[model samples]
Target: IDVGLQTKSNIGKQEAADRAVVNLETRYQIMNMVKDFVRNPANKNQMIPFDADSTSASASIKAYNELVAERIKLGSSAKDNNQALQALDTQIAAMHNNVVSGVENAMRAMRIQINQVNQMSANAGSAMSAIPTEEREARALYRQQGIQNTLYTFLLQKREENALVLAATTPKGKIVDHAYAQSHPIKPKPMMVLFLALVMGLLLPLLLLSVKKLLTTKFSTQDELAEIIQAPVIGEICHNRHKSQLVVKPGKTSSIVELFRLVRNNLQFLLTNDGDKVLLVTSSVSGEGKSFVSANLAASFALLDKKVALVGMDIRSPRLAEMLELQSLPGVTAYLAKPGMNLSDIVQSSAEVSGLDVFVAGAVPPNPSELLLSSRVNDFIDQLRAHYDMIVIDSAPIAMVSDTFSLAKFSDAVLFVTRANYTKRNLMNYLNTVMSRGQLKNVSVVVNDTNPNVSTGYGYGYGEE
Candidate 1:
């Protein structure tokens, strides 16, 4: 009964809303017709009359048309300044206002009816929805109660069956076989424990070594560096226990000095041509013994009485002067900044190496990269070529700065130095990238600071002091 009443109310309200919409459209059309006749009543169409409709707006238009016709007739008989004509104008304006007001009132009434119908329809819909909602909730509650009762009955049946089984009992029997100890014990097998311990003891160091090798990211041995770089390792200089910069002195016969001698001989084979004199020494980063290599390599050449000039081109970080215990000023920076300055004024002869000359980095410059790009650098290399048999430039690190690339064009060969266990594997990959890109030419690697014990194992102990 409740649902039926709500449905009837919804249907009635919906029909009312439809009627209100139709009335609104009719009123809107009538209002337009009245407004047109009032605005220009003289041009009224005879075929489609505004007064044909039964709406109040249609009656208003008919009255307005009569007033217009009356005004036209009175104007033909009266003067322009007559009082009757003025009164007629006033009447026409009042009637025009009345027609507009009637239209607004009709539209406003239609809108109110529409709003009321919509409210009633919404209320009826809500009422219609509640009946079904309550019925569904009641049905759901009944279904849930049935499910609970069924579940309880099933649980009680299972419990009763279990109780009956527990109350009843079967006949007891004696043990057919008894537990006994076996001849061989299951635990504490001395042979197996000892075997396992022996196996672990044998494999532990190997496992640890394998793990250490896998975790190590830097080059620790000569074979490791060579296998990864795939480049010629021209020399492997041993770790200098004395920590001297000039390990290749004329009279020194230690392992470090002999290694430098080997490097000097290898370079001789690599740079066979006389013009292969400009050797640029650099590394992936700083502290890889590049300065040490550069200074010592030049000194080794000097021992052969070859005129050698070791130039410090790492102007950003001048280490040659400090390593060689020479003054930093009036060297490369001074020579390049002042074109008129003589090369002799900046070049200083090493006291230790009689035939070798040292061109210090002078001072740290604000624009070292730009300075290396100058044409004077090439000219400096050319001048050194004319005077010396060998020119070794200790330039900036290739990875850390672009200054080395700028100076690389002036080199005949590049000696890349990487310290043992100090240079990362990724940097070696970067070197490969550099080589693959052909950014450098005639490149060779020199592994510095290798363990002396490891070197002796490589059969290079013949010259050890």
Candidate 2:
């Protein structure tokens, strides 16, 4: 309502200014008409607006018409003086047409302006009507013509008052305005926009990382897997183990064979056909499936028709060579103590798997770590490698004794058996320190007793991604 009222007031001022313009135009036209009327010698001294009353012309025309009607009613012979009658009729017609036409035209023009005034009044809208304006030169001319001086004096005063008012109401020529006051700005509040964008840019990456951590159940990196195992992760096989096979055969599968193939692949890559051919297999504590991996890794290579010998290298506790009911023989400890002992004398063949061989850790060594670390043990490994295409050497765990580290340097690769939620972190830290010092160049870590439901656990499925 306030805005409406303000707009109305401004419009009122504008209308008054417009009306003043029209009044000035009309006054000019009126002066022109008066001048034209007086320029004729006959009308120069004789004509006065007060003398030439338009209302009087109209009344005379009406009265003459009434008399003409009465005369016609009195006689058809009223035209006895034809010349005078004709002259009277002609003068009446001219007076009547000119007076009525002039007054009607003026009134019609006035009505156009009156319609606008009426509309503005109905709305109580902003507008005003200014008094008719006169030219200064015209007013001076009127004074020179000896007309009443009071009228000109009054018009002059009114003109001067209005000029002062208009000057006051209009803005100063140099009034300050916003540079874009005439149009809208395109880069409004640009600094604020940039600040907001910068904030979001920093936050989005953190938001995505948080969301990823929340949704995934499986471990993605070696570090995470190591954390779960509570053991040092000696190494990693980047690709999935299950997808690859030792050799392709249709519609047949061996879970044991496949796992061993992975172990063998890692072994061959790390071990590089070097020391530790006569290996041992044992866990920190039992039920870790150390026997399973040792047994299968031997057969996985044997399936290629290669002579792969699986030796029960764990001397303190021995079960690998006995699982299949093989005859007991003086194996690793015997070979370690007597460098003269031959590899063929101790090895036995597996009836269950062809091309595969087994050997027991005949007698548990009193000092397995010291026995395995002997110079004679190094000779034993070199002797076995000459006869077999592959040799899977399973060793005693570092968690049980430091013996594994002694054997680690001699072996082509060290495959650490880690049970989920079994091995402690501090023990593994010691083992890791040993490996990092290049004690075992080809070392790999495998997770056992792993929960398959965990995305990063064993039995993880994969293709090319």
For each candidate in the order shown, give its overall lDDT on alpha carbons: 0.77, 0.55
Extract clashing residue pairs from model 2: 12-126, 12-127, 271-412, 279-393, 280-313, 280-394, 280-395, 281-394
Task: Return the TM-score for each candidate structure.
Answer: 0.57, 0.43
Candidate 2 C-alpha error for residue 425, in Å: 3.3
User: For candidate 2, lDDT tens digit of each residue in 385-440?
Assistant: 77787777766665666666676655555566655555544555655676567765
Instruction: Itemize residue pairs with steric clashes in candidate 1.
Output: none
Give the count of colliding residue pairs in each prediction.
Answer: 0, 8
What digit string (tens of lDDT, one per residue) describes model 1 on residues 186-244? 99989999999999999999999999988999977778888889579887887877756
Runs in model 2 deviating more than 4 A are 1-223, 226-256, 271-287, 338-340, 455-465
Q: Which structure among the candidates has the greatest TM-score?
A: 1
The best candidate by lDDT is: 1
Model 1 segments more than 4 A misplaced: 1-179, 185-207, 457-465
